[model samples]
Target: MWTPNVNTFFQIFLKNFKTRKTDDFSATRNSLCVTIEAVRKFTTKRRKTSVLSKKSKAIGFIIMSAFGFAMMAAFIRLAGDLPFTQKTFFRNLVAVAVAAVVLCREKVGFKWEKGNLPLLIIRATCGTLGIFCNYYAIDHLVLADANILNKMSPFFAIIFSLILLKERASVFQYAAVLAAFGSSMLIIKPGFSSATFPAIIGLLGGMGAGAAYTCVRALSRKGEKSARIVFFFSMFSTLVCVPFMITDYHPMTWGQFFCLIGAGASAALGQFGVTLAYANAPAKEISVFDYTQVIFSAVLGFFLFGQLPDGWSVLGYLLICGISVAVFFYNRNLERKGQ
Candidate 1:
């Protein structure tokens, strides 16, 4: 990665110019040009290597995030028959504790920037609702199905960003969205059956998550700290769940209690992993890797719950994942051309 300094280059050029005759001036100038070109090539190569290294790290972090989320979903399913709200409370309770510790360690006071309160509320509200729907889905649907449905948040985020943030999407992105929606129908398999209800709710949960993520993007752009945003959402969700949790509280055995705790910890791992991932690289680069959660969930479901997705569900997974891969490569190609 090292290259000749500008000063050093000039010094060499001047020395060559002084040592050579007037007839050799052209040769000296050409030599300097060659040196400059070499340096440029070296630096460009180093930069590309650095970027590749960062993308590698981002992929690893995102994969870890996927596994963390899959584990969280599995733990939720393992918690047995309990109120979704009650489970949500425990999840956020752990988040609140973790967020509080982070804030304390960072010495960042819990203060929202003025005019950001409304967006914070929106983020928390949507996030709480999303969690409720997701927990319910985990309780009712197959674990992999629930995981894949929730993973639809990114596409939903695109739509919400367009609406809320006034961001414009390209034709390919919109096409990807449409293809994703059509693919999701393969899993939803809409009908007048009781089973389909949870799938619909799961879809709505993905939409809520997308909306919440959209708000988070806005807040981040407005200079909100990640820790504060997480703390606010965790606290807000915890309080929102209090009343329902109290009223419909089901007694949990020690095992179930620990399972919920495990869910919360795994969720925190996912949250932090994703945060680190995107910090290293843009979503377009690493987001497709998040689909790994579906595979992880499928493995867990099969071994633990004897759950296996049927043929249609498998088709849905392939289409959705394929669409994501296409979108990812399309975005990368555009970036390369722009560069």
Candidate 2:
């Protein structure tokens, strides 16, 4: 869970080789022994690479998390079969109840800063609208496709950091952002009517979430617990969404109620995992790994929903993945130098 400095990867990589060298040599014979031993050691070394291990575990976590999130989307899609406002309202209402129980059990109390009130309200508004777009988008598109587009939030975060936070932009970060956007375009094929407005809404959802993240980052320094922030969001979203739900009310079947429960639980889980990730690792260190959500979405889409990314979409996915990884290392290296 620790985000290793650049030196950590090098040290770990070298240590693995040294530790395996003897066993590696024993497996080989006379003339080609040395070469084979070296190759064996190298292979083993790469296989045990800290970078690869961190990335693999990070990606795995994301895949599991994304599956839950995708299911949430599927629930939203089903809910969309009714009215969007009504569905969204119920979803947020359930989410509020769920979050409240968790917060109560944990004794997570909130002490609102007078200065942070406006920011809190703003973030809550953004969160509500973001959820609206996300639910609306998934209703019109495949759950996996909508998710793939939604995963672009990190790219937007990187860009916004540069513009708003005045954070230094490394070439790799720029490349990662470009890759993310390019891949998204490939996946959705912007301006194509075949993909239509829902795709754009999905993209907007990413932007909205991206803005929410930026606000989270901004308020993070103000010493608020992430859970408290999430709690507030759920509370406010429930409040705002309730009025709309009553006007557009529709009776729900038990199946739909179950789906709503599942969506709330999964979303809460994913949000907690994300918060834990930041607690365990730096934002930039963990941010790039988020792109793995797309890979997960693509695979899940194909298997669960019979949705597949086209060749162009595949290419874009690769670009996004490559750049995001590059940015991770770039940031890690910077962190190593105490930047």
Candidate 3:
């Protein structure tokens, strides 16, 4: 007769329950209790192994998401030789068209309530600014450097969360901000063509993005439909880009056009993937995987642009990632305490 440990028994029982029947919270709770008991009994090494496994899974998802975003960066850089506004115009056009086709096919029309329009507009404006700044940075900076700098978003998000959302940040979040700023300075050292304007744009874009996300969180509370929000973004951005599309636009080569398509499609897919990630996993768990963007950007930059970040830059990457990891765990700990 084999006597299984609580955790082992819990795993088997949960697996069987998931396979056999409907998802009942009572059953899940019982299984979870068993698993917790087993966890309590586990040796330190076993517990460490379990923690590592969970981290690995979370890292995998984040890495995938970050890679998708990096691909968007590469494509944007390739398309940036065109007029900035024109690039924006076509990209938004493609995205809007794609979204419209999907909505029509699915018969998922959005009903716009008057009260929600302001929130929707605000979200769209923030997204548009972020995309615009990112594209402009791609045009001006080395691809890897731009990506590394853009990773500052999470850091900025921390501050914005404090100011706009009135949420207190952990010490780890402050450390992450310092690390990101340090990394950015390494990339754009002083007296390097005054990258100040572009950097400011990037930073503001990041802050705006955080505010947009906060609004999304708020809307989610009120049961606002994400599809409606997305629809507003698609429609509004396309409308805004119309003047840019008409003036000073040049014909693009097939290659250039294809690159724009790639950027647009990746943005659409990445948007959906990121939404799902935040929904399924804790932000702390998902955010750490964002570090993979540096790796992806480095690889893509070297292969496509013949640009490589220096040792200082690489070290900076590590520092930024380290801080971000610390922040994630800190937030996770806070969440555990129900704060």
Off by over 4 Å in 1: 1-61, 113-115, 137-151, 173-200, 275-287, 308-329
lDDT, residue 89, candidate 2: 62
Q: What is the descending TM-score order?
A: 1, 2, 3
Query: Who wins the lDDT comparison?
Result: 1
Superposition TM-score, candidate 1 onto the true structure: 0.74
Best-fitting candidate, measured by TM-score? Answer: 1
For candidate 3, give the lDDT.
0.63
Count clashes in each candidate, considering only residues at least 3 apart in sequence or on different chains: 0, 0, 0
Q: What would the TM-scores of all predictions be?
A: 0.74, 0.69, 0.68
Question: Candidate 3 residues 206-259, lDDT tens each?
Answer: 666556655554554455655555567767877887887777678988888999
Candidate 1 vs candidate 3: which has greater lDDT?
A: 1
lDDT of model number 1: 0.76
